[model samples]
Target: MKPGILVISHGSREAAWVKLVDDAVIAAAASPCLSDIPIVSSFLEIIEGRLIQDGIDELERQGVTDMYVVPFFISSGSTHVDEIGQAFGLPWLTDLEGDLGTFRVSANVRYGLPIDDDPEIAELLAANIAELSTEPEKEALLLIGHGSKEKMFHERWQEGLLKLGERLRALGGYKRAEYAMLLPDQAAAKLAEMQAANPGEAVIVVPLFLSRGYFTNHVIPTRLTGLEYRYNGKAMLPNQAIERWLERQMLEGLQRLNEK
Candidate 1:
């Protein structure tokens, strides 16, 4: 039988967002090379059924010797990815043991690169901005991300988005593009200022988030609703590029397991 593929995400309380990720993975699996393989997903938090270990156990039960666990993360730099790896105690491909106990049902897991890493991601954000902005010259785009308290992860996210903003500015369409965090202070106030400066023009509030969970669906919209401007709520959707990248990583993980 073909190896089973498990796409693991941090999971979310938002059922619709979870369905979005599920749909994206299913669509990707339709590719001829991956069609025969069984592909499933589970969350680390929220929503139950197939946790990380459950995915492993299911694959093992099926007599499937090869398994691929791909974290649908936007960054390899996140602590969640590191923690997940440590929890599994599965060394990456380079250090696999050849014994059946090790090889019989070896898991090949790869944490994904962040969405900000993709060049096309900027384009996607820009497209959303265009849809929100009625008057480009007077409007501003505020990209809000879930910033981490951990210095490294937070910095990486900040840097990545900043670079994305720079690229968008180079394209020379939007008048102003800036990033903000959910953590820290005065996010709503900052957005208000942008609206104040723009006067009559619209303000596009884009959440640089993967899924529409508590933060994206509830908190963000609630906060922005009070703000003065044309609030065009365009949350990010799962796209083909993200799915393809995830599948490629899964395939690579499988290949590495075979070598061991």
Candidate 2:
């Protein structure tokens, strides 16, 4: 049973974004668990030939029979996860339809979940904001995510963020952890609410994105135009935790395949 790993993320036109994912893949491939296993980093869209189908084709060409398709997304709530799953003939994580179309998947596909509420991810978030957090115990961590209007997806986003917040709050010893989504444009209101609710707490805005890109740079800040919160817009990339997460996914996939 030849096995391979395909780590897919929502692509960006920016070279840095793609490079981060590829670099993480390189980091993950060094793990002892993945020794001699072929691993490819693919994108949901953009980045041309490195798209999901292209990655799958590359893996199959390498004679991989049981391929582990890892969804390197921030939340299980993402519509892209559903679309990607649908594309690979797996059950959708949401009720939404997939527009990504079907892929010519010849390998035994085993789809993995997203990075939702992981303990290490919570650490990554805490570490990302460590510089901005002068007094963590007196600060309110406001997590900002690209949310969904769809009921199921939105609920899933909140669920994951809620758990992640709990973990981060404990990890950082912060006063509290709050969340807002750029979608439906709630960053300003959430910021206002967090400040009001916490009174003397310092609100620290953290973008719950995979990497630093358009959302973290432009969209998130624009949504908080008149807000009074501390923000540096650091995202979850160029960090070693992500490589550990990727390696975990591949290991779990191999374990599942062996069980079968």
Candidate 3:
């Protein structure tokens, strides 16, 4: 049986946003280590025709009987992550309230972890922020997340961002590092508060997101409009580190499958 991969991401209406995710998956699949593997990328929602079920069907059509699904999300605590797990009939670490509906595929499927607070990912985030921090000693780093508004979902988003914030803080160059969500009425106030608290310090705002899209480009900037901070609206994309991370996950998945 041929082994294949299905890369899942949160779908977007913006063409640029979808392209970013597709590009990353294509680049990662091109790696020599991932050679000959049929890797299909799909979205959770929004985009028509290229949904997660579509990805599964594509893999099955290609004669693949064993499939590994790699969810390319920023947080493990994301409800989307749980929803994807349930879609694959896999037990989740956290209870997900929403249903993405049921999917039936002939291929045996295994799920991969989201881009959680992995040490390597922390390094990637640090690199992205370090470039924005002109003076690490005097600048404060603020990481923004696309948190949920729903009570159950919001808590998970907060939990993951807070943990990531701590890791990013420990990366050690900044005066202070904090995280805030776009929802639950905290993002703008937090940004304003950070700037006010450190009158002279440069507040570098980095988004805790997977790619540069509507949220990173439009929403975040609009929310921080009156705040005094430096934001280039950079996201975690066009980085080789993410491909490396995916490769590791695939290899780990293969190892686990082999063990079983």
Among the numbered candidates, top lDDT falls to: 2
Candidate 3 to truth, TM? 0.90
Positional deviation of residue 90's Cα in model 3 after best superposition, in angstroms: 2.5
By lDDT, the better pick of 1 and 3 is 3
How many residue-pair clashes does candidate 3 contain? 0
For 144-173, candidate 2 gives per-residue lDDT tens digits of 899888888999999998999889899989
Candidate 1 lDDT over residue span 9-105, tens digit each? 8777668888888887777777787766777777777777767666677776766656667777755545566566656665433232222132223
| Best-to-worst ranking by lDDT | 2, 3, 1
lDDT of each: 0.65, 0.88, 0.80
How much is 197 displaced in model 2, in angstroms? 3.1
Tens-digit lDDT track of model 3 for 1-260: 68888889898887877887877788777878779888888999997789988889888999998888888888766778887888778775555445777787998888888886788888888887776766687877787887777666677777777777778777856777778888765778997787777788788887888888888888888888777787877788878888788878777766665555
Model 1's number of clashes is 3
Candidate 1 pairs with clashing backbones: 74-113, 74-114, 75-114
Candidate 2 residues lying further than 4 Å off, grouped into runs, are none
